[model samples]
Target: MKILQDFELLFQQELHKLYDNDEIKAIFLVVIAEKLGLNTANYQLSKKDPVDDKNSAEILSILRDLKKHKPIQYILNKADFYGEVFQVNESVLIPRQETEELVDLIIKNHKFSQNLNIIDIGTGSGCIPITLSKHLTNARVTTIDISKEAIKTAQENANILKTAVQFINADIFEWEYIFSNQHYHIIVSNPPYITPGEKKYMNENVLAYEPELALFIEESTPLIFYDVISSFALKHLAPDGDLYFEINQYLGAEMKDLMIKKGFEQVKLIKDINGADRIIHAKKAW
Candidate 1:
């Protein structure tokens, strides 16, 4: 069996070939240390020291998975978002930094209230709704997803996180038929916005591993989810209720225009950490 020292050397060399991000390598190493029950602090202290045999074997196994393009979060089964650790798996899309920025924008701009009812459409892993519920304390939050696997994973996450978020398994297109009269104070979605034409440009890790339904929108109808959700908001959003979406970076202006055309007021597109137009916010007329 290889020792920890040997594993570290192998990790460094293999990671250098696989990932360009230095921080990703650091995180992968830390996860490996964590999985092996090694003293992470001590391991850091003795960076040059050889790892013991048992830890080295486990880490070597993990490295093999990583080389296969398995996401570290899926291998670890947990991810950190908005200062909280969340359970994650292949069943749900990994929580992303861009979505965190969307959540931050929502929290910063919206007033919290016990009676504020919020719905998060396409709620993968329940990240947005659960985080909003944790922060809002008394807000009534409901999350919906078309994928049964995603819904199940999201429900498990809610239970584990000890956050109260109502999970519903239903497609947004069928929402009106399923729950016609339901209205909310806030409606939010980070729907599948990647155009099908862009699939070739996405990394293999994402294209191969992440759920395609949660990633792609047909190039011909890129605004499919937006159109459906906006229609729902128009008919069901309480007067003066807000609608929020994490949108395709390349189509923010078009999204804003669509919202305005649908009778939404104050339609605005906001940039994310990468300075990409990433979120759209609008209010239903009272």
Candidate 2:
């Protein structure tokens, strides 16, 4: 029970029923790396070393939460996103790999531009805007969120990353009142696109542990966030600017059609690594 190897065995014994072998190992390794600062090589080298009573207590506490299907990131209060770690809580959704692709796409498309102005809607953990600010030093970034708690957590992340992303507490639906005349060269968002009906297909850990406010939309309005943000972009984006979104896989064609109907000069639907229709880029005409 005191040895690091014993803790690894404990994870397997406890979580084997809940997770597959690879998932169990990945979760155990992440917990060990963060909680004990041991990488896989070092973990293997020191697996038999006795852990202190305090560390053992902490591991047990985390294991208890894992039993309840709590996300490891929330249990540790941090998440890995776009090559950096961000603070996370139930108030905000954990960053995802699809979002990283969205950020990478923006960086690739805008890296050469000078003095870019970009804004991100729905700033959960501030990952999108903050990562953009870090990579695109010439850009001024603004991010908005409806939840004050999400803003607070995201602000902490921005501060930690030392990225100058302006965090605003506002609803995207009311952005016109807040930023009537201001224009951005790039507008991006990874807003809530999960329909309530789709919840049945998602894993229990996500459905039970993650924040519903940042995940689900009414089935009646599957495009609520996308509908509002993209429309707002048509008004607030500068001439020749671009709008980007991480979209629902099922609604890719519909989203592309919506962007085209909104009169974007060019609309490109891009797939994620998993080949899901995951991102959209809509360019405004000059």
Which TM-score value belongs to model 2? 0.96
lDDT of 2 by residue, 136-213 (tens): 857899999999999999999988988888889987776688888799999998999999889889988999988898
lDDT of 1 by residue, 1-286 (tens): 4545566666677876667767555765666557655566766666665556666666768788888888788888888889898888888899999999988887876754557889999988889999998887588999899899998888888898888898889877766776677889889999999998898887777887888888998889999999999998898898788899999999988999999999899888899888999999999876
Candidate 1 positional error at 199, Å: 1.7
Clashing pairs in 1: 4-51, 5-50, 5-51
Which number leads on lDDT? 2
What's the true lDDT of residue 138 in model 2? 78
* Number of clashes found in candidate 1: 3
TM-score of each: 0.93, 0.96
**How accurate locally is residue 100 in candidate 2, as Cα lDDT from 0 to 100?**
94
Q: Positional deviation of 176 in candidate 1, in angstroms? A: 0.6
